[model samples]
Target chain A: MLELTKEPFFGFSLCMFSYIIGIKINQKTKSALANPMIIAAIIIIAVLAVFKIPLENFMIGADFVAMFLAPATAALAVSMYRQFDVIKKNWLPIVVGCVVGAVSAVVSIVVLCKFLNMPQDITASLVPKSITTAIASKLSEQLGGIVPITLAAVLVTGIFGAISSPYLIKLFKIDNPIASGLAIGASCHALGTSKAIEIGEIEGTLSGIAVGLCGLVTVFIAIFL
Target chain B: MKLFKKTLILFVVCFISDIIAYFLPFPFPGSVLAMIITFLLLLSGLVKVRQIEPVSDFLVKNMAFVFLPSTVSIVSYLDVFQSILWQFLLICIVTTFITFVCTAYSVKLTVYLINKRKEKTENA
Candidate 1:
């Protein structure tokens, strides 16, 4: 059984199998917290721990899966282009909103982390927490952060935005769909955008646009940070 | 064959972006450079939507699956997470709300100001 772990096929198949199960569980539970990535990661980690399989062995095949990261990040252009018209019309508010959102996210994380005496590395990871995973992970790598922690921070931020946006909207008296959607995407990325889509078509579309724009803004901001 | 062609195009673009990133002074990400290039290509009518659609859609939809291994790597650093779990959770909650509220209001204010200027100009 331990020998099987050496084969790249073993790791690849295990990853696919676990993720499919994760998706199935998500479908059954219908809970926002039942994120397929979280479920799949837990399952894979548990299996490796139980079997005493070295992470290095698992990584041999996992590298193949990670190859898609670059292409997928680039493919974000397709969706961004689709929102070009809305962005053109509301470029002022969108640009201002994303810049504000990205700055606040980084500033708040740094301030809070410093106040709590969290280490510098963890603070770096949390700086990119509000963006999508692909861009966030890369930014984390660039900032000398631990990628896994960055992933964890991004996942939590996204879930929080998805769950709290509606209540936050009411609390703040935010009436415009565009404003609401931009806020959600800037704070939560795609996860919150899913909820925004449920709220309204315009909200969803604008939220989607915010994800890409906010990511771009944060990338430039990170260079200075 | 078509899927292969589209995937190849994306990979080729990624390859070019990687080269471009290598020549830059700053530690820019090649993947992001690829994103910008792809966006420009699409916007300028150099790359049609349908050309990249099928493969791009698959990659985006199943994106989480691709990152599972990276997430699994967290198992190696369990100690870091265990020590900072509470602080981490607090930061996430606090910062998410702060960013959300700030973005929402700034956008609202900008729109309001734009409309006010529009009204003033109309009267003039």
Candidate 2:
């Protein structure tokens, strides 16, 4: 049984199987906290521990799936293109909102990191927390940060954003759909967009567009960092 | 055949972006560079949306699954994370809240200012 771990198929099958289970739980619960990635991560980790499987052995096949991340990131262009009309009409607000959001996210993280005396790698990992996971993970790698920590930070930030955005909107008295959606995407990425969709169609569309815009703006700011 | 062909185009774009990034002085992300190039290609009509639509849509939809293994691998770094768990949460929660508020208000303010300017021009 332990020997099976050596085959790439073992890890590949494990990841796929766990993800399906995770998706089922997500659907059954219909709760934001039941995120498929989070559930899958917990299940896989538990299985690996129980089986005494080494992380590297599982990584053999896992790396194959990770390879798709690049093309997937590229695929985002298609979605952005899909939103070309909305982007054109509200170009000024979308661009400005994302820029401000990205700047604030980075600046606040830096300031807190400095105040907390956090290590450089952790700080770097936390810096891209607000961007989508694919971009955040890659940016974290570019900055010499720990990729896993960055992934964790991104997930937590997303869940928080999804759960809190509705209340945040009300608290801030944000009446505009575009503004609410842009804020959610900037602060939370896809997870918040899911909630934004529930708010209204216009908000959902704007949120979706904001994810791409905020990602691009964050990457641009990372150059200066 | 169609999905394969679309995936090939995206991969080719990614491959070219990697080379471009390798030569740049800054540590630009190859993935992001690929994204920009793809977006530009789409905008310029060099690549039609349909040609890559199916594969791109599939990739986007299943993105979380692709990252699952890495997210699970977080267990390996548990010790590092353990020490900074509170700190990590603090930063994420505080920064995320601040980012949302700032972005929301700025967008509202910009839209308001734009509308006000338009109204003034209409009055004139």
Candidate 3:
């Protein structure tokens, strides 16, 4: 009777162990399909369910880790700061790409939701789904959306971005490093940037820049419009 | 010690952004606001990149792990949230591709035009 659920180490160790395993599996496979976040989430949930641990118990220590999301997001500035030269050269394309990317994501979601006769609450949640989960979840709350639904949508969107971005670039024969990275980050956020970083330095820098730019664009769009 | 200072700087910036967003009618996500504010500060040379380097690297590199608590939240919403699962999932997948395509094409177009303008100037 360890009462593992009551102890803080239980949740913290569970997540760390799962994520570390996730990274290793991803490296061995050399595929984005086995995303570490998805893998870790599934493993953690299974462990909790198998032991019948209440979510409240798991969230205690896990909550401290989650608080990093905000500062981590703001850290996009560090990436931008590092790549000031690239950003300075391609400012217009970056801005335009992110704005267009945000608009297209929101518009297409609205159109599809309405076409499918989806409910308004669900639509509100889905509207900002293209943004990073941290910002999207907050936007979802502000728009009277189901926060979890929005988080789920944002994750799925990111997964699509990560798995499909390389394919998308190849299918379209996109050669411009700036354009490719910008597009991936604009659409995919951090998940896509991981792939971009694999491709080259230019794409990595631009993609990192795109994550923050698109987040800002989507937030303003979600809040004001 | 240095990491603490960097975190404090970012924390202060994030707090100010949160306050600004709170006063607005539209509830903007404060962290994103902080991101923009920080970006500007960096751009203006107000905050040197070296100042936040250590903390930012740790935060960004391990960003995926930070999402653990939120992703685990899926368990709580399994009942009410998944009612429209098919539609929501369908829309998410389709729009993601569409947005990706549009973003890439738009960036391509802008770069193309910029290159064309450069070519024309060189010719002149």
Candidate 2 lDDT over A1-225, as tens digits, reads 677788999888888999999999999998988888788889889988898899989999888889999999999999899889989999999999999999999999999999999999999998999999889999999888999999888888988898899999999999999999999999999989999999999899999988888888888899988
Worst 10 residues of 3 chain A by lDDT: A1-10
CA shift of A99, model 1, Å: 0.7
How does model 1 score by TM-score?
Answer: 0.98
* Candidate 1 local lDDT, A61-160, one digit each (tens): 8888998899999999999998898999999999999999999988999999999998889999999999999899999999999999999888888888
What tens-digit string does per-residue lDDT give for candidate 3 at A112-209? 99999988888998998887666777778778888768878887888778888888899999989888998888787777888899889889888888
In order, what lDDT does every prediction score? 0.92, 0.92, 0.84
lDDT string for model 2 (B1-124, tens) is 8878988999999999999999999888899999999999999999999999989998999999889878988887989988998999999999999999999999999999999999999999
Docking category of candidate 3: medium
Per-candidate clash tally: 0, 0, 0
Looking at candidate 2, what is the lDDT of residue A9? Answer: 90
Lowest summed lDDT across 10 adjacent residues in model 2 chain A is found at A1-10
How close to the true structure is residue B8 of candidate 3, measured as C-alpha lDDT? 95
Q: How much is A36 displaced in model 3, in angstroms?
A: 2.8
